[model samples]
Target: MYALKEREMIFVFTGPHGAGRKTVAEMSGSTLGMKQVISYTTRPPKATEVDGQDYHFISPAQFVAAQADNEFIEVSTVNEHLYGIKSADIELMFQQSGSIYLILNRFGAQTLKKLYGEHVVQIFIYADRATLEERMRESGDSEELIAKYLSHYEDEMAYRDQCDHVFENVDLAHTVFDLTKTLDQNLNRNLLDLD
Candidate 1:
């Protein structure tokens, strides 16, 4: 694919688990016609997930082989599963489209920010603890997993202050609408800068 002539934005969506970060990222990709940065995960796919769409599901052995070969820009273990973003994949995405969005944890967000500087826009989405728990349960997460996520709530929340934008995700439609507006303004500004 040909690269976009003008740089637009790389949106990194992150928040505590169950905060609707992935949902917002997915919505933005579909609603705004943005390219998605899909990561590789060792975790088994959920009933609603599709390989290469939500994530590239691989075996633990495959994950380790890729890691040993330095295939990832950032890697993290969550719930005993390996997750990583390949450096080549991200570079290719940037080359193909100026507008790209990804769902990431705080560590991945920080790594991308360090690598890309001003080109990366970090957005933190969060909701109340009760709402988080409800959402997790509704999504069919195990009770143990939900408990574990809640245990690290404070740690995850602390990263919000470091983000470029933070928004409560209690209302999905409103949040997405606001996010799209933010992206549009940023895109317009960046396009103008190219001239």
Candidate 2:
């Protein structure tokens, strides 16, 4: 667990599908004093997912209206479903003393980095192809869906080099430890360099 005395810092986590970015983000936010901003999606909620916890579920019509109104900070469509992060949601998360962790796709992360510039600390999470395939299979996804994800994986991998940190999440425990250490050092540096 991290010492709560550390100042807040916005962390952006991105990765390929089934890379466990959301799980790692939630764990990191709980360990550190930060808020995990649950994104909104037009897709139906999964069996284990809870509204307002995993995501803010919305209808396609509502999502389209929001997009037209420019309510989303970043939005993207994947596999025919739309997902978005709202600007107001981010503002609310950062309102307190704690940091905000935004778990998004590469396109969303790029949009946020363009918007926030140096205020964002981007982390790319990754796993071996076999591990990712096994994970997707365990999740009960169809072969067609898995193949689609595998096709898009390379594009997301290309974005990894642009991140401030690349976390290979094959071993969750060790990855979390390394992530915490890296975050601590980065936070301390940012604090000391505060103007």
On lDDT, the candidate that comes out on top is 1
CA deviation > 4 Å runs, candidate 2? 1-8, 189-195
TM-scores vs. true structure, each candidate: 0.89, 0.89
How much is the lDDT of residue 27 in candidate 1? 85
Put down candidate 2 lDDT per residue, 1-195, tens digits, no spaces. 122233556789999988888888877767666788788999888777899998999999999999899988789998899999987777677676457888888888998788777777999999978889999999888899899898889899999999999999988877877787687676663323222
Steric clash count of candidate 1: 0
Residue pairs clashing in model 1 are: none
Query: Candidate 1, residue 130: CA error in Å?
Result: 0.3
The TM-score of candidate 2 is 0.89
User: What's the distance in Å from true for residue 98, model 1?
Assistant: 1.2
What is the lDDT of every predicted structure here? Answer: 0.85, 0.83
- Cα shift from native, residue 189, model 1 (Å): 6.8
- C-alpha lDDT of candidate 1 relative to the true structure: 0.85
Q: Which ten residues in a row have the lowest lDDT in candidate 2?
A: 1-10
